[model samples]
Target: MLTSLAIRNVVLIEALDLEFGAGLSVLTGETGAGKSILLDSLGLALGARADSGLVRAGETQASVVAAFEPPAGNTRAAALLADNGIEMEPGEPLLIRRTLKADGGSRAFVNDQPCSAALLRDLGGMLVEIHGQHDDRGLLNPRGHRALLDAYGRCDAAAVASAHAAWRAAAATLADARATVDNAARDRDYLTHAVEELSKFAPEPGEEEILAAERATMQKGARLSDDLAAVSDCLTGSDGGLAQLRQAARRLDRIAGEDAALAAVLEALDRAVVEAGEAEDRLAEAAEALSFDPARLDAIETRLFDLRGLARKHQVAPDDLAALRDEMAAKLAAIEGGEEHLAALEKDVAVKADAYRAAAQTLSAERQLAAGRLDAAVAGELAPLKLDAARFRTVVAALDEGQWSAQGTDRVEFEISTNPGAPFAPLAKIASGGELSRFILALKVALAERGGADTLIFDEIDRGVGGAVADAIGERLSRLAESNQILVVTHSPQVAARGAGHLLIAKSSDGTVTRTGVHALDAAERREEIARMLSGAEITAEARAQAERLLERV
Candidate 1:
């Protein structure tokens, strides 16, 4: 149930804080005293669309916070909050806040932690349901009629949902397989040719990098050949370092043993001769390693171009050529064996479709039974709201095959007849403003526990009728309060007096600033307010006595 609402700098309301209790609460005042403003503020916190014009003239922003304490066993709201990662514990108050900027942008928060407006709307839906004079939801919206009937029937919605999903998934698979077969059949020749061509090249992953690196090295090798050859000639040709060292060695060997120092010089000359021969051998090997044939360069270039051309044709990188070839191979295989596979998929789809049909038919039968009961229940509530002659009907009709959905193959609508001889018509098309409210009240009272809402707000539900008719609407509201908290904005004194808690919306001005205020009424104050509502602008002894009798009767 909504526990509290606080508004700051909202249009006519400069600052306001209100604590709400359980059961039916009524808000009453003169027409322009800001009763609608109060509901609007609450709506803002309930994730309704925000407008900068709601801000007070001198304020830069308007803020509203609504705190809700969910019932002990109601975990739907808790689950949603948990899914969004908002911190909330069972039985703890869930505070929803919205701050509207004067510039037309607003921020929303859950328990003071910043969140998106969508999350607030989702959570608010579970916490409160607003039924205003213009509201046409609940039974009036045909989209929800089937589900409402299912709920009344105690049908397994989850099972139906699962069956429907299974059928859809199977159908999707069959469709995709058929599409693939159709496309592949059209391109069978091309796919087969591509597979054969790619198999001959048999491109391997990472081979492109290796080949590119080898080509780069050979290109550089060609540029360095002249310098390498010149170095080789300088180190190993006649009169080069190796030949000159050997000549010196031979001369030293002839003068060996002429003196001790001369013998040492001959030994060093012989060692230099051996070392020079080794250096010459190494230089020859280095020249051989640098050797490349000019024709080989052309061959390498041709191979590189062939690989690039194929990559371009396939719209893939050189490295992805191998992957593309494998994909084409699979497509060819699919064409070769497609008919058998498609038959198997078709069988699967048929099986799933049969299962779904059975479930939907079973559900439809139960809905038919539930419909009769729902109509009877609604009929019981109609007479009490002074609609004894009206008829409330829940129509469940078969839909065409193409109209089948996850819910079922049925079109459900709530239709009504205002007179005994008139034909039943769609509720929205046939009911007047006051008649609609009364009609909705009957439906709501019949299906009050459907959504398990924490709070139900009715803005001017008793719009067109008064006296006995007004009292009857008040009686139903009181009955609704037994299961959920209800708030009604009313001009009917009977409805106002039926409220367990009463609030008066009043407007005042302090010379410079005008503001709206809400005050909880005490017993004595309640009597005065009720008297004023009954007589208008003037309270007489008779009105006070009548208010007392109304209070006593309750």
Candidate 2:
């Protein structure tokens, strides 16, 4: 429930602090007494749109702070705070403050922690609902009717939502499967050809580098082999170095006995021949080692070229061709087995759809039963509000499959027939401004303890009606206040007299500056305020007596 509201430098309200209690608190004053300003200030604190015009004429900025004390059992507000990462102690008050500068800038805070205005607005919605003739945020919107009905009926909407989610998940899976299978079917021929080509070529990792290195060595060896052959011929020829050395050594051996010098010369010549022979043998071995068949080299070159060509065609490195081969083969296999997988997905989707339908039907049934009860309840309220002949209906109509949502497959709307023979039409179309307010009140009275904001403020709900009708409205409001905190802004003395607490909004001028003030009326003060409401500008003895009697009835 709203605990208090504080305003600073807002329009005519220089500074005002008003504390509230539970039950129906009424704010009453003459016209132009700044009642609207008070409401606007509260709206601003609740994250309504900020305007520079709201600032006092001489002030640079305006601010409002609204404090609320949530019930111990209310987890919705706690969950909302937790979601936004704002902390409040278990029993602490939730304070929302909003500041508007003259420069058209604004800021919002919850529990003095800076927060987005949107978050503050959301929290405000959970804590309070302000209704008036032009209200669109609450019961006026048809979109919220389903949730309202479910709340009223205690329906298992979560089950329907869960089932819908499952159905959507299954449907999405089926769609993806269908798309995959269709694409694969379109590329069936391409996949088959790719797999066959990659299989036949059978490239391996590191083969490219090995073949390249071997090709380089073989090319170099071809050049070296020619030079080696020439060297071998020179070493083995009849007049080559080894032959000539051997012949000279043989001649020197024959003359070696004649002189010691000739023996030394023969030994040196033999050693030279031996060294030459060893060189020739080493060269032959090297030539054999370096030797490579031209045909084998050609085959290596062809294999390298083919590997590069395939890699280019597939947009991959030659080493990756092996992995690509496996991928294409897997795709081909999936295509072959796609129909069976698609059938299974279809079955799952059907099962999920059936489940969703069952849950939605159950929810719809609950809503239907609740709607009947709601209509009867509202009908009971209509007679006292002077709409005895008007009919209220809760239309829970089924929607098309394409329009189905987590909210279920029904569209709920509150319709009314204002006359006996009139066809029921939408609330907005069937009721006059005064009638609409009464109808809204009737619906609210019926839905009082079911679910809604803990604090409900109705602005001028008893505007057009008076006398017994005003008293009836007051009685209903009192009844509503039994379960929820209610605030009413009214001119009707009967309505004003029924308040657990009363506030008088008044404007005063100190010659230069005019300001609006709100005073919480005491018992005697309330009598005078209500008397003024009954007697207009001047309070009379008769009005005072009537106000006293009205208070006694309450």
Candidate 3:
């Protein structure tokens, strides 16, 4: 239930603070008394869209705040707050504030802590529902119709929980199956190439790096092969160098007999000649091995190209291809054996679908029972509201094939007939403004305990109504207050008389500034306000006596 509302610098309202009680409260004034402005301020605090024009002429920003005292031990409120990352204990009061700047930017807060407008909207939805004169379409919506039926049936929580769980389970199974199928299709071609490449190379992890280094060294030496060959030829490869050295050594050895010094020199020359011959032979062998083979180079290029190409195709580096191949193989294996897994998933989906169908059917049956009672109750409310001929009907249609959803498959709508012998139509299309209000009142009255948020606000619910019909509407609102707080802005004296509290919306102009003000009415003040509503701008003794009798009768 709302505890208080405060508004600052909002259009005609410079500043205002209003406190609420736990029953039906009425706000009354002549037209243009800023009754709509009050509701708009509350809407702004509840996270409605803001416009910079709502700010007062001299003010840079407009602000509104609403405070709520959530019912003790209300699990729904506690869970909702917790889910939003708000820290509040059970039974604690919650405050929401919204501020808008002249530049059109806005900020929202929960419990004075910075929050998003979305969060405020979410919390506000749980705490208040504002129905205005233009809102006759709420009951016409098929989505809300089911909720109404559930509230009437008192099975909303259980039915919604079961359907949500079943839908999620089925959705999960379908998603997993779809991902498996997509992966198998993507990897179909790659799997064969991967297996072939791994088979041929049989390459150890570091084998490529070692082989690449050896190949580079050998190629570099091979590049200078022609120079090495020329050196070898000049030294001794089928050439005259070794022969000349041998002849010189022989001539020196023969001449050594003539001189002993000559013999020593011959011995040194012979050792040198032998060393040169050994050196030439080694050079010739090295020249022969230094030749390059184009065929080996081609093989190395082809192997590297295959690894790199495969890596590019798979969006991985060449070295990481090994891991990618293994992963692809695993996926292929899963797909190959997908039939067994797919069957399991299908079974699970079927089970959840059946569970959802059963729950929806059971809920539908209960709704049918509840619908009869609702129709009876609404029909009883019609005569007093001057619509004795009108008919209120809850229509339900089951889907041909069960549709799994958050709210189940049964399509529900509230239909009405405003005149005798007329065909029933959707409530939105059939009812007039006053008729809709009366119908809404009847619905609210019937499900007062089970329907709605902690606070319900009706802006001009008594529109297009007066006399006995107006009194009937007021009676229903009073009954609705037994379970939830209700606020009504009205022009009907009967409605104002029925309120446990009455507030007067009056506008007073001070020079250039016009401000709207609200004041809680005492007993005498209430009578005067009711008299004014009953008469007009002028209040008479007869109007006062009538207002007094109306109050007494209530």
Number of the top-ranking candidate, with lDDT as the measure: 2
Model 3 lDDT per residue over 1-554, tens place: 89899999998999999999989999998799899899889988887888898888889999998888854545566677778788876567888889999899999988778888877776676677777766633454566777878888775547656766876877797788769767786777777677676656554455457657656756876788878867766666445677677888889887889999999999888888888888887876776566557787667767767766766876876677677667767777777877777777788788777777778778778888988988888888888878788888988787666464667667778888888899989887777676676777777777654645778888777787688888888888988888889999888999999999999999999898899999999999999999998889889999999999999988
lDDT of each: 0.85, 0.89, 0.80
Whose TM-score is greatest here? 2
Off by over 4 Å in 1: 1-19, 30-129, 151-154, 216-299, 452-454, 462-472, 491-494, 506-517, 531-554
| Superposition error at 421 for model 1 (Å) | 3.5
RMSD versus native structure for model 2: 8.0
Q: Model 3 misses residue 72 by how many Å?
A: 5.9
lDDT comparing candidate 1 with the true structure: 0.85
- Please give the RMSD to the true structure for each candidate, in Å: 5.7, 8.0, 9.9
Q: How close is candidate 3 to the true structure, as a TM-score?
A: 0.69
Write candidate 1's Cα lDDT for 512-548 as tens digits: 8899999999999999999998998889999999999
Q: Compose the digit string of candidate 2's lDDT tens values, residues 1-554.
A: 99999999999999999999999999998789899898888888877888899999978999999989954555777888888899877788888999999998999999889999888787777788888766666677787777788888888789999999999999999998888878878999999999999899899988899999999888888989889988988888897878888888888889899999988888888889999999999998888878889999999999999999999999999989999999888778879998898899999999999999999999999999999998999999999999999999999999999999998999999989999999998887767566777888899999765667888888888878999999999999999999989999998988988899999999999999898999998999999988888888788999999999999999
TM-score per model over all chains:
0.73, 0.76, 0.69
On TM-score, who's better, 2 or 3? 2
